[model samples]
Structure formats: structure tokens, C-alpha cells
Target: MLMLLAAGLLADPVPVYVIAGQSNAEGYGVPHAQLETIDDVTVVWPGRAQKEVGPLQAGWGANEKMIGPEYGFGQAMQRHHQSPVVLLKTAWGGKDVWCDFRSPSAGDFNWAEQQMKTREEREGRSRKVGAFFNAMVDNIEVGLHQAQVHLGRDDLELKGLVWFQGWNDYCQWPVEEAGSPCGRGIIERYPHNLKHMLCDLREALNDTTLPIVIGELGVHGSDVPKSRSGWALRAFRTAQSETASQLDHCCLAPTASFWDTQATDHWECHYNGSAKSYLRIGRTFALHLLALDALPDGQTLKWQASQKGLQAMLRRYPPKSGGLALWGSSIFRLWERAPAHFSEFEVTNVSFGGARSWETLHYADETLFPIQPSTIFYYCGSNDVNAGADAASIAERFRLFSELTRDRLPHTKIFFGAINRSPEKKERWAVVNEANQLVGSYCETQDGRTFVDLNQVLEADDGSTRQDMFLPDQLHLTERAYEGFARVMREALEQKVQSP
Candidate 1:
């Protein structure tokens, strides 16, 4: 290793992940003796008084007799990167993001202020508002110092953050009445506060694009009861998902799917104190972090995050192979009524917003190949053209896409949807038209490739772009526009595609 480092072959900086939240993040699950210590990963847990920095093992939980999500999370991180990993864990039991873990930008925590006053009166000193947040930042600095000493290297990158919280904000602060004060106070503010916390942490670390994984609060399990408490939990989970969706380089690991329903290890809110539940949650978090990290340059982070959630959905409810797949950018993603439009067949729209041709190719293996759809309506390259990619390059990407699809699903038919001449890209309309022409020429020569001219329905009688067909953004389509596009697709599929 020293020789490799001297030769600059092992110069990649070590990845340091920060894991912080409430009790669950602190850990409560039981650890078995068989759990191995990962040598490549170093955990700096400053939550304890000793502030130990060492190899990750089963015992680094809330106590020696228990384990937390960090155990599996650290191991998976090390395996995925195959490099030295450092974890900075600073979590407290029964803490809430709206108060105890609140960041500076989340505003003053009134409840914490009162508690601080009381504690200061009793004791000589007390932790101020946003105490946990402050401690977390302080611990991260300490962890980095310790990590540099432990590894005998100063090159460490804060790669990701793992957050497993929401119990106290959801369950502890129940919103019984519709539009209750409690609802607005904590539940409604949860998403905003969490986003602020992440942004604030990023600013502190000076890494704007730090990847984050939020563990879904699934204490009530998959089947949340039809009660006030259940409703609160559901809302909290939604808030967490929404925050992850809105942020770049962030994803949510749905722990409800990995719920210990049988209570194999034990039973209670902390995932039934089940090691299996914690392990699964940690692994899922690692997978999401990996997905975010693996996104190619210029590929949108939120789209990969969206793909992560969509993949989970596909796993839980696998789509039938040999169906109609509408894959592309926002044009197809915003078509929520796609199923009703293509009622004739099983249609799966795996499109995402702001997706370019290259991004589609990058994500095709994981998102498109799994279904191996019989036919596809590919609507992309609009973003690419807008991004200044030449017509030839965009067309070649489509050719590459077709080749990949042919290799995976030999008999699958592909329809290259012409890039829409939307008002948003009026300046690049010339490039869009040239790219469409190039792709059309290529598709005509291919065996199973067809070019569906969407501009036919999208344009008006005078050969001008129909402004009414577009939404206010001048990029996306309106309801009437989708109707016309659907009609064109239905006709093409019926006339061109033969039944299996």
C-alpha cells in the first residue's frame, strides 16, 4: 500500500460519511457475535464521552449489547468503494429535527430555549438551541482530525450523509385534528427543517453536492393503521420523500418494505430491535448513496434519486415483460395519465424530468432493460439540443441506445419520438429539427426502429409551433397536447407493431 501510494496509484481520497439523527441513528438493534469488524472502515463516534475512533464492528451502537444502522452501513460503504471509509456518527436518543437537531437556518427553537433556561438554572451550563446540530458539526471536525491520524493521511472527502430519524417528529407530536397547531408546528415543518439541516451541513463542509440518504420512518410498518397516529406517520414519511425528491444528490430508503413484521429479533418502535431490519435499512442507504455517486457527469442527481425509488417500486411490483415502455425526459415523465391514455396495453413510463439523451443511455440498463418491453416510445434529445449538443452527436447517442436495446431485447421494437419543437427551445429549434432528421434517417435503415414524428400533431396548420399545446413553462405539454400525441402513438403502434 505504501509503495502504491508513493507511486500515486492509490491517491484517491478516503470517503468520509456523516451519519446523524435520533435514537434509531444512535442504534438500538441487537448485534450478534458473528458480525465481523470491517478493517477498511473507521467509525468516529463522538456521541460517547470517550470519542473512540476504530474499525467498525457490531458493538458500536447505543450500547455494547446493541447495534445501530451504522454497522451495516459502514460495511456496505467499504465494500462498494473498495477503499478506506471513515464514518462520523453523532446522534442522540429521542431527539427531534425541529428542535434538538435543528440547524441554525431553521430559526430559533423556542422549546429548546425554555429547556435550556431551565437546565442552565439547575446546572452551571446547558446546551444551547440546536445543540445536537452544533455537536454534530464539532464532532465532524474532531472525526476528520482523528481519521487523518488513524490512516496517516490528510486526504479525506465528506462523501455522503445518512439520516435515520422522524419518530419523535411524527409520533411524539401527534396531529389529531385537521390543520391542528401541532401539525403546523412540527409535522408540516419537518421537510423544510430537514432540507435546511442538509443545506447547512453542506455549507459547513464546503461541499455543495454531498450525497445524502434518508431512512424512511417506518415504525408502524407497511400497513400504517387507519388512525390519527398512523396518518401522522404517513405524512412524515411523505415529507421525507418530498425533501429527498426536491434536493439534488439525495434519496430516501423506504424502510417500511424492510420492516421486521414478524418481530424476529424483538418488538417495538425501533424496528422491533431487529438486527435484520437495521441491516436492510443500512444496505438500502448504501445502495442509494452508491447510485447517487455513480451518476455520470452532467446527469441530473434528482433523476437518479427518482430512478432509485422507481426501481424499488419495480421490485415490489414487478412489471410484466414485453409491454409498452414510454421512456424519455420530462415530456414522458409528466404524463401521469399515460396508463389511461394507453389503456390497450401495459404501459410503463420510466421517464424523468430534465433527462438528456446521454442520461437516458446511462440509466437504460437499470431502468429500461428490466422490463424488456416489446415496444418503446423514446422521447429525448430535446434537453441535449438545448444543452448545445450537436445534431450528429445526439443522433449517434440514439443509435447507441438502439444497439443496446437490440442486444438486451432482441425482438423489441423501438420508436424514436421526434424531439418536440417546444416554445422553450425555440432558439434551438434548428438543432432539434436537424437531430430529428438524422435520427429518422438512421431509424429507417434499422430493422425494428421506427421514427414517430410528434411534430405532426404538435405543430399547427401554418407549420408553426402550437403555443397552446405547451404549458406555462413553454417546455412541457398540456392535456390537449398529450391527447393528440396519444392518438398518434396509438395509430403508429396499431399500424406498425404486430401482435406477439
Candidate 2:
């Protein structure tokens, strides 16, 4: 048994993919089959954590991007690789690699454009240097830091980095010519600018050997008329293909397939891909990143079936069930784990499996908000190690949960439990402990909401060891530990019931 355990320690971790870029890369070109589910993956909204009912934000914001809330690339990679594959997505909408995402409103190229415009007016030529390059380095550095918080203190062995940009540069054709953010006129110099952007990104990340999948821009066919240069949007596809040629780890994925296959309005930019095309975009991207380049000889993907046009937009799902819970991979038989009292409550164990906060909050509605569970519990925050989020996020999550409880189970009392402290797991996990304290304080101020002290129970009376609570990895829980949490939760619920 000792030898077997030692051998298992040598096994490699599950592959994980990281994706970034501008809005198109963030899922703008191809919205999911439903606005909520992208590529058969669900978007876990963050708001449901507290009590207010609001729209779900795509990708990770306060919380790290989990494979569940973002069940797209992560799930597909895990399935194809036949192992767990965690996908870390930090793409920003309308954000250029050449701007500061920390500022939120830093995409103000108008300032950069104005300086360049005045220079051009004075010198009769485009400015020789643009600040886009330096700005991108900051973004890349910040992005790397954010990834590091979730990734352990080590050089994360990255498998792939999906690229869905160049539109900003391509869009410049019209913008720089028209002198605006939109297509005003055509600037032939823009595509070359895109190449510069790509090189700058590769250099900044020092990731020359990493595999990258480039996604082309797609219009819903109702783009501005240009029987000639008007359709220059299509040329972006060619440019992406060209960028892939120069980069050893780069390849291109045509996104016209993200279009709606059901033949909805071709004018709708979101539903613009055929289903087969969408799957290909997802599957082939994963395959190439895994070094399966020889399969596609002339740009054809080997999917279970071929899809074309509007007919491809149709999608199907295995109906929701209660028989078995879903793991992060969605394909693996996951070991159940949590912060406190997961098994004791049918509160839609939304903590693990990295879901969008919104998805985690609302998951119970599909599971057992009304059917069972007197109070809901959620605890996850290490994802916010940097870019410091305020109590507003904790408040927002609590507010959403409160609202959801009122809507689903009006009589139900919602309890906001603090995130637990990971003693010796990843160093960044310490950040989650700080956020958890805030959550505890935040919940105490609420009326129907009660903040439970999970830490006190897990820790020894003197703040020492409750050794049974955590596993050897320090990330997961031991069976006795899960049961201990549940037992303590039962006592808490009993107290709540007696109080009111």
C-alpha cells in the first residue's frame, strides 16, 4: 500500500487551458446555444451568492472562472484528454491587450487616437509609435498575477491558450480611416498592426512554446454593405490564419460556425454559427492544443457528425437530474467535498466545481430550494487574491441569495456562511480566509440572513488543530471531516429552528 501510494504521487495533474483576448474572445462572436449556456456549457452567474436576483455575468469576476459556470473549454478538454482539465478564463469584454483592465474604463483609445491624430495632422503621417504595446504588457502581467492566485505557487504547466482577437486591429481598418472606433474608412495598415499585437503578447508572456488557437471574427451576414472592401470583415479570418503560420504553437479556428443553425435571423450577430461549426471551434481547438495537428489536412474537423448553416444551431441537453451530482469535469465521478455541512443540506452544493457565482446561487432552484434545505451555504474566494474586490461583492452575492430564497422559498431563512481557511494548500488560498471573515461580518448585519461561524467549529477551541476536518492535500476534505461539518450544521439549524 505504501509503494502504491508513492507511485500515485508521481502522476501528472489534469491539463488546464487558459484563454484571453478582446470581446470576441470573451464569447461575443458566438453567444451560447442559449444566452446563458455557451457551447453546451453553463454560465454560473455570481449574484446568487447573497440574495438579490439579477442577471449573471459571464466568465469569472469576483470568483475565479470555474469549469462549471464555464463548462465549455474545461469540460471539452477534460473529455478529450480523458483526464481532468481545468480551464482558467480571464478574458475581458471590449478590452484591448494594450490597456489596463484594473481601471475598467481604461480602454479609452480616443486619448491615444487623439494624440496620434494631431501628430498625423502636423506630420502628415501615422504616428511612428503607439502606446498599445506597453499597455498590453501591464495587462499581461496583471493577467498572469490573477492566474497565479488560483494556480499554486509554481510554474503552472499550461497546455493551451486560446486566442480570439485581431478584430480591434482589423476593426481599425474602418476606425482609423473613418477616424473613430467603428468602421469609418479602410486602413490597410491595421492588419499588420494585428501581427505586432500578437508578437507583443507572445513576448510579454514569454510563452513562445505554448499552443494558441486563434478564432476569426464573424458577422451575422448583415454587416455593412461592401460588395468590394465592405466585406473586409471576412479578411480578418485570413489574417488570423496568417498569424498562426508564423507562431509554432498557433492555429486558427473559423467562427462562422458559431452562427445560429436554426435559421433564425441572420441579422442577429450572436446566433451566427452552425452547430457543427461551433463544436469544431471547441473540439478542434482542444485537439490542436494537445498536439494533434496532423488530423486536419485541408481544414476539416473530425467531429461525430458534420453540421452546416442554420440547421446546426439546434442543441440538446441531458435533462437535469437528482440521482448523481456533477463534478467539475462533468465527465468524472467526483469525490464530494465542501467548506461545511454540504451533505446535511440539499442546498445545491455550489461551492466547488468553480461555477459562476450567479449559477451557484440559482442552482438550488433546479435542485431543492423549495423541496429541501432550510438554509443555503456558499464559501469560495481565493480567486480574488489581487484586484481587491470590496464588501460590495460579498454584499451583492448575499443580496442575490436573499432574493433567490424569497422567490423560491419565501419561508426559508438563508444563512451566509464564511469561506473556510485552507491551512496548507496553495498559498493564495489564504486570501479566501480574509474574504470569509468579511462574509461572516456581512451576514451578521442582515435580518433574515444569519452568518454562521464555520471557522470556530473547524478550528480547535484554542485555534489549534481539528485534524479530522481537512485532508492531507489541505485542499479537499476527509470523509470524517465532511461528516463533522454536517454534524455541526445540524446543531446550527436546530438552534435556528428554536430561535424563531
Candidate 3:
């Protein structure tokens, strides 16, 4: 028996993929029919005996009838790799990133500590931070070891991680509670905490550049309305994108488009608990992993649109003499819908949706220099801060942008728009204010530059943004807000243009 076990332990290791998160990762999918099975794939999930290992199929959830992303993910991996695969899944329902899965390396937040204390009082146990993180790490380790022992092979390679979470964090706490002096909520702290979690996991696993695929929390489909919760969700989603973009060997799988409202009896946002929804998400996750695997070392996957279309647009609509250009992120993109006219000067919109300050720096040649507008109206940096960048980093990026503009268009009048206050980022207003100050200071130093303040019009007396001025997502402005923005922008531009 010992000789046989030794031989099995020495065999080739199988590729293992670990999936961790909250309820979505645990899956609520109710399969319509018998789920397909992959012979080459196996799964180890938390069970009555700490964990249970079985062939990859639909019954990985708490109940045997339920399924999650793992089912489809395993099938997809088997098809692509054509070898034995192991999936280790560890997730709990209603867990937030700020506390439940917070990484050990990310120092404790007072708000999270308070919540932990509350829970401790109620449950009569001292709950530690990173509880889920610890459980996940331990389970993955145990699952892999068990797989090695059961299969008699020492070759179980940990290939990747699939994270599908955030809804809990978005809904658990109010944005006001995340404000300074108290501490930040999970939504505000997500990107930084997520980055820390990724780093910590990689370090623990002894793989510095482990591949990771983060799934977007898409309970409501693509057209997320502007509401308090919608605002929080959008913030979390933006953080997910930024974390993936900044890290190496990482990719993001969008799931909002796959949501089916009529499928399940549960919450409409939970993809209606549709098995098909989970399956599609899982397949997409696997595909992204495969794509990442195909990339060369030090090269990260770019999930966003390429700059080719923007470049083509620039060529098609070259800036006319005395033209004006509006550039920034989704804020400017939405402004394109406004019927406001620029009769005094031709206007061209060179903005892209979901653009960050760093992205603006990179595409300056295509979006900025070529247009060479007489005046430029800019509104960005919110996404950068949402993506975990500090005020200093945002200021540095803006400084670079300013330098670039001066170098290319010395005569151009640059109007730096202060990053707007939003209900989604109520807790982060200080950072926004600091970034605006830096940007304003930078503009003042330039010969033909000025700063436009939107907070005066958008922010309420209590410092909270006016809810009526924004849509359900809370980040994007309402039509009314845009009108206000237009007035401010036009007034500032007119003043600058008329100045001696």
C-alpha cells in the first residue's frame, strides 16, 4: 500500500483553479435539466466533512440541485487544456470584502472593526478580520493536498483564481458611514483591499504573478439605473476594473449583459438565479483565463476597447481652426447627448467612457495633440480615485497632462474641471477635494489655464451631493446636472476667451 501510494504521489500534477467570493461565487443557479459533466475535471467544495470531492457537475452549491460558475468553468477548462483539472471552491453568502474576505496585509478599518465587534457581541465569539480570506487559503491548501493524496500525484498546479463578489459590500453599509473620522465602507476601500488580497494570495501560494479573473457584479443588466445602491454597485464595479487593469496576469469578465430577470425566483439582480447565467459567466471566466495564459510574460490583458476607433474618429473629424474639444471619461461621453450648441466655435468630443487619468496620459497623442482645439474642457480623475489612486497620484497624472498640453498646444486655453462630488463616493470627497486643489494649482501656474469648480453647484450644504442631480448610478450626472455643468463651462470658457 505504501509503495502504491508513493507511486501515486509522484505522478504528474493536475492544474487547479480556485474560485472565491460571496454568494454569487457560491451560485444560486437552478439548473433546468441534468447538467453536463466533464470526465477530466473534478471539484472540491466545503461539505459536511470540511470538504467533499466529486466530478465537476451542477451540484456544487449548498443544495445538490444548485449550481454556480464552477460547473461551466470546469467544462470549459477541460475542453481547452485536454487534461485533468481540479477546482477548489470556497465562498459564503452575504460576505463583504471589507471584513469577511479582507486580506491580512490590508490594515483594519475602524468601521469594519466596529462591525466585527457588533457581530462578536451578538454571536459570543471574537471574529477576526480576513475570516473568509483565512478560510479560503486554508481550504485551497487542504483541497490541493487531498487531491494529491487521493489521486496519488504530487503534481497539482494552482493555475488561477476567479473572484465573483461585491454586491454584499455594496449593500451592507451606507456611503455616509464610510466618511472620514469613522472609516471607509467596502465599496470605497475595495480596489486597494482587493489589490492587497491578490498580492497576499500570490505570496502565500508562492506564485508572484498568479493569473486572476475578476467577474463584474451584474445583477442589473448593462443599463444600471442611478439609485443609492446602483451608485454603490457602480463604484465597486469601477474598482474591480481598476484592480484588474493595474495588476499583471489579471483579466475581467463582464456579467451584466448575461443577466436574466425571468429565470429565478430570487432577487432580480442575482441574474434571476439562472443556471444559464452562471454558466455563461463561468465560460467567459475560463476564456479570459485562457487568453491571459496565452500572453507573454510581463504583458497584461487589455479588456477595454482598443484606441483604434478613437484614433479613426480623430482622423475623420480633425479639429477645425478655433474649435473646442471636450475630453474626459463617461461624464463627457454623456454630455455628447446634450443638445447644447457651440455656435461661436466648432466643438468636437474626444472623450471615451470609463477613461482614467493615466489612460488620458497614454492616449494624449491621439486624443489631445491632434485635435489642438483653441480651448479644451476636461473632467476626469474620479475614475482614477475610484480605482484606488490617491490624491497625489491623481495630481501627478494631471501635471503630466498639463505639461503635455503645454508642450503641444502652447496657445490653447485649458480648463481643468474639478472632479465632481458623487453620492457613490461620498466617503472619498476629501480625496476628490485634494485632487481638485492640486489640479487648480497646476492650472494657475500655466499661462492660459483655469480651473472650473462643479462642486459649488452639485454639492449640498451638508457636503453630500444632491441626489436629484444624478441618475441611479449616482456617479453619472442627470440631465439637469448636465445643464448646470454646461452653464458653468460656457461661462468659464467665455470669460477665458474674452480675457485680454
Q: Identify the candidate with maximal lDDT.
A: 1
> How many steric clashes between backbone atoms does each model show?
0, 38, 9
Question: lDDT (CA) for every model shown?
Answer: 0.78, 0.44, 0.75
Residue 207's lDDT in candidate 2: 66
Give residue 278's error in model 1 in angstroms: 0.7
Off by over 4 Å in 3: 1-13, 46-51, 110-126, 173-184, 297-500
Q: Across residues 298-413, which tens digit of lDDT does each residue of candidate 2 receive?
A: 32222112211111322232222322122111101123554233444332332334332333342333233323344554443332232243444534544544544453344556
Best by TM-score: 1
Model 1 poorest 10 in a row by lDDT: 175-184
Query: What is the TM-score of each predicted model, taking all chains together?
Result: 0.62, 0.40, 0.57
lDDT of 1 at 41: 89
Residue 224 CA displacement from its true place in model 3, Å:
0.8
lDDT of 3 by residue, 336-379 (tens): 64435555777777787877876675555445667768888888
TM-score of 2: 0.40
